[model samples]
Target: MSDLNTSRRTIVKGAAWAVPAISVAAAAPSLAASPEPTPDIDLSTSTPGAAGVVRQTDTQMNISATTFRNTGTVPAEGLVVTFAVDSGQTIEGIQVFGSDIKNVAQGATTSGYGTNTVTLTLAPGTGLGQVTIAPGSEYTSPVGQDILLGQAGAFNLTVTVQASNATANSVGYMPAPQAIPA
Candidate 1:
């Protein structure tokens, strides 16, 4: 009778331990395989477009202007402009479009007479090339013009503008916040 009682107690203890162990093991899989979510970032800014130059008259001295804004949380630097210029006309250099309320009719930065002008000479021939993107560096902004040797009809010019530390989007060499001739 004593041996039988001891055997019964052993069976009950074994069952109690086994039940909890099995339950814990079974529950662990659900916790390990659960899915979690990820996070994202936000950026918003504006870029300048290509400057437009049209023959207001039939002289080599045509009118050109480009307007650019930061439209971001910070300031931009080394803005360059690139465009096609006719070799027939003499490119006198770059001048600022001066007029308060809406400046930059001449060029970029520091308004007033003789204050905002850049002298860029053009080469001779039909395809006179110049970079608003400065020499040695890869990008440019703050527009300027190439002095031409002669005149040619509406040449196709491509301008590239960019900024760093804020936002930049480029389709090939051209970056975002762009303007083009109408």
Candidate 2:
């Protein structure tokens, strides 16, 4: 009986000492990455077709009239704008336009599209090469550029704009809400 008591005391003492030793040992560190900073994207609603940007649609095609600007230090890159039209609707073509509004005209309000713009062409599969917007640069509302929605009932499209750089990446939907309407 005395031997059993002695054994338990020895075991407890050994464990208590081992815990402190293990805890004091050095550990590499935690593996969590810091979040990257990003610029803000603002969107507006453009009625169907405007400025030859989008084609006419059967159902009231509610397009985006919003424009985006890089109010941050970093530029937004690798931007791919995506969306889907209903069965009756058709995506005739896609277009991306950019401009230096402040440079094109003077006294232009803080809102509205920019001039000195160029229609960015898309690359097959990858769509267009990365759309890079430097700080102070901006793009049109990116509305359903040249989209033709034939029939209108409840139309939903997953419009995503993915912006990425060598250091960071971000994804977001267009200003307009999405609904996969049939």
Candidate 3:
């Protein structure tokens, strides 16, 4: 009986010391992850702002090829990104940032067939193929002829990016301090 009691006491004392050390070690890695700095990719859509003839409330939006720009740091090999639109909208005409998005190709084909093979498409469930973005570069689509959204949808523009370098280790908009205030 005495031997068992001594063993139990030894285990409890060991745990008391181990618990705090384990906790601190576990917390260290979490402190390292957080708001990874990525370039700001802003999005703009065509919505009839307040300057409307009749304050168009429920009108369809004319999305002329949305653009994804790399205003952040330039990736060495370029960033691989995908662009997508909501279910109610359609994607048409893919082009470079400075160029206008046009579904209709105006150039010759790769096979000497006098046509182009590449195309741009983004629907609710489907996303456009990933494209590389050179540093300080942007990709724009030709004026989407039929991409339309509800009036309310026009008011909000959401941009989601999936990058290995981008981390969500942030509390609020800022990084939490590693050391608690003394």
Candidate with maximal TM-score: 2
Which segments of candidate 2 are over 4 A away from where they belong? 1-62, 69-74, 94-131, 135-138, 142-146, 150-153, 164-168, 174-176, 179-182
Question: lDDT: which is higher, 1 or 2?
Answer: 2
Candidate 3: list runs displaced more than 4 Å. 1-60, 74-130, 148-182
Q: In candidate 3, how many Å is residue 102 off?
A: 15
TM-score of each: 0.30, 0.42, 0.27
Candidate 2 per-residue lDDT over residues 62-148, each given as its tens digit: 454545555555655534445554434544333323333223222221221121112222221222332456666665544433343
Worst-scoring 10-residue span by lDDT in model 1: 37-46
Q: What's model 1's lDDT at 114?
A: 25
What's the lDDT of the predicted structure labeled candidate 1? 0.34
Error in Å for residue 166 of model 3: 5.4
Per-residue C-alpha lDDT of model 3 across residues 62-145, encoded as one tens digit per residue:
433435544445431212222233334333323333233332333211111111122222321112423444446655534432
Full ranking by TM-score: 2, 1, 3
Q: In model 3, what lDDT does residue 3 have?
A: 57
Clashes of each: 24, 8, 10
